[model samples]
Target: MKTSMAKQKKSKSLLRREWVKSMVQNRYLYLLMLPAIIYLVMISYRAMYGILLAFKDYNPKLGIMGSEWIGLKHFKNMFTDPYFRHVLLNTILISFGRIIFTFPFAIIIAIAFNELKQRHLKKTLQTIYTFPHFLSWVIVSGVIFNFLDYTGPVNSMVAAFGGERKVFLGDKKLITPILYITDIWKESGWKSIIYLAAITGINSELYEAAELDGAGRWGKIWHVTLPCIRGTILVMLTMRVGQVLNAGFDQIFNMSNTVVQSTIDILDTYVYRITFQQTPDFSYSTAVGLFKSVIGFTMVILVNKLSKKMEGTGILD
Candidate 1:
């Protein structure tokens, strides 16, 4: 027993020494990662303590730690609230709508950009397309209001064209589609950068081989380009699936008004309204946020698993 214990102790000490040596060897790499590490620790990990507020009756005077524990009370209320159910349904619908409509635009745009032969023209077009992503939702909303408001250019054009003026923003049926369109317009170009990078990394030999096989541009794209970027697409898709619950809070909040509020009231907006617009219920709001997080986490795990099963690899892997 003594001999075995000594061997174990010596092994542990040797492993520690090796780990220290490896760390010293990669000191520069660690230095490069320091800012991200600090951000995760200070901004993300530190905020995790607030999650406890979901199970507590939070009071400003009492503080997070001092608050009375009311385990599952807020969760029970959330489950029973009809408005919450409606909000959840809306969130799911809008999120799926974006996945269906907005998600593919990035891939398509990336492919189109890759096909452009003129470098200067491609760069100019890419700059024009990606410029919208930098504009905040507040600015975008103002532009939308200017274009879609009553007596705006669109309405004026409709009037001139012998058609009735339309309240585009106020129309519930139009709002969801508008959201998808705006999201695609603003984000698709910037998001395409990833796929473009993936495409750049693809071996040119594959394309040459396809060309030799009498494969044209379309054939090369369908076979070589797409197959090469399939992993990146799957990884991106898995990450997007993880965010299934987040249906653009900033965009929805800025664009939504009383007329279309009910139709676009997602979980984030619902929490915001309950917490700030009406009577503040910190515990309930926290509970809602927690629920959203749990659902998102579950979605990520499930999708990652599905990706692994289908492709023999996953985001987590």
Candidate 2:
């Protein structure tokens, strides 16, 4: 009994010491972080109460809290609605396609840029490549429209070859592909920055050692360079999974017309159309939005957990 008491006393003392140390080291940092913590709690976490509207027959005068609750009504409507099903499928397909295609291209750009021996040319190329990313999708849509118009440069080229000018924007078969390719082109170069930073952080000594072992360019890339940056790639993939539902809202909103709306309508645009145009069912739109957010949150958690289980590190850490 005496020995047990002594062990308990020792544990209490260790806890006290740790508490004191934590107080000294982290007290100021905690104070500094307080404002941001509170701001997030207020703006992000607090706004979650509006989710209650998802269950309500919300009215502007009644407000969210005063609204009449009808649980699962909106959710049932969503599943049964054929248009919602199509948009949901399109959203998932487009988002996943972008994640798979864009990540590899970013890594390839980083690796290729890393090997450039000429400083001026490399910098120039980097600047040029990144330029398109800053252009708004509205601008991009205008550019595409001009190029694909009947009398535009692309159509003119086709005409010179004795081929007919095609209306690309109105073509349902080509709309989704056009969106994906344009997104890749506009964003891939800018996205390479993170991967390039990871590549540059790799130890130069490893490259030297590989060269001494007669490892050629491809050998160094496959064995040394890629392995060093695998952690960054995994983290990127995890973050991308979290953004799987948020596939380029501005791009789709600006580019979509009545002609191809059915093919490219994502969850976000669908919500917008339902709330503002077709029917002013704010509660129903909120319910659909809430569903998308829940799915995205689940995807992030699952992906992060699987990543940790496989490699022992995740994006959160």
Candidate 3:
């Protein structure tokens, strides 16, 4: 025991010395990271104080700390409200829809990009595909409107093709598909970037070995490339599970109209509506937001457990 204690103390001392030396040597690197660190502390960490408002009956006059404690009244009300179930259902459906459709599409795109023989062609396609991700949702919505509006190009095309013009944008049945397809268009290309980078990190020797073993391109991708990048894919999926409640405020805000509101309204839009458009029930909104966050946190834990059971590798681990 004495010897083990002495060894532990020596190891800790060495760690402290190395930490000091690394800090002195990497001062410039730390300087580059300072702004991001400050923003996280100020904007993200500091804003966590508002979560307490979920448990309180907030009053602008009484302020945050001065408000009366209401326990789980807001949370109970949120769950019992008439539209709560529909909103919850919408959030779940949209979240899983993106995962099921968009996730595999990204992998396919990454593989397609990697298979390109011409350097110039690959670079051009990459840029073209990734450009839409940078455009704000508002801009993307306008572009969609041009295509899907009653008298828009799509409707004009239908008219020319001897079909009746349709209300594509306002159709309840079409709203979910439109949202999914447009999001896939804007994000799938960018999402593939990480997978592409993971593929790049794989050693060339594996491909060469697979080739020697008579594995074709698709065979190599299935047997070697995919196995190597499974870790990244698993991590991304686990993170995605945590965000099941967060069905993109910007896109939903821009795309939703009264006609499809019942089908498309989610936790985020519900929070926004109750906070600003309605009575500005700060407490209720905060409760709804908190409920979403708590579920998100729980989701990460559950997914991590499921991943470990299925893959023998938990994302958190």
lDDT comparing candidate 1 with the true structure: 0.94
lDDT of each: 0.94, 0.90, 0.90
Rank candidates, TM-score, best first. 1, 2, 3
Better of 1 and 2 by TM-score: 1
Worst 10 residues of 3 by lDDT: 308-317
Best by TM-score: 1
Question: Model 2: number of clashes?
Answer: 0
Candidate 2 per-residue lDDT over residues 1-317, each given as its tens digit: 99999999999999999999998999999999999999999998889989999999999999999999999999999999998999999898989888876668889999999988999999999998899899998898898889888899988999999998888878899887888788878888999999999999999999999999999999999999999999888888878878889977899999889999888899999989988999699899999999999998998888889789867987667
Error of 2 at 70 (Å): 0.6
Off by more than 4 A, model 2? 1-42
In the predicted model 1, the residue pairs found to clash are none
* lDDT (Cα, 0-100) at 243 in candidate 2: 83
Candidate 3, residue 31: lDDT: 100
Give candidate 1's TM-score: 0.86
Cα lDDT of model 3 overall? Answer: 0.90
Model 1 error, position 66 (Å): 2.1
* lDDT preference between candidates 1 and 3, better one: 1
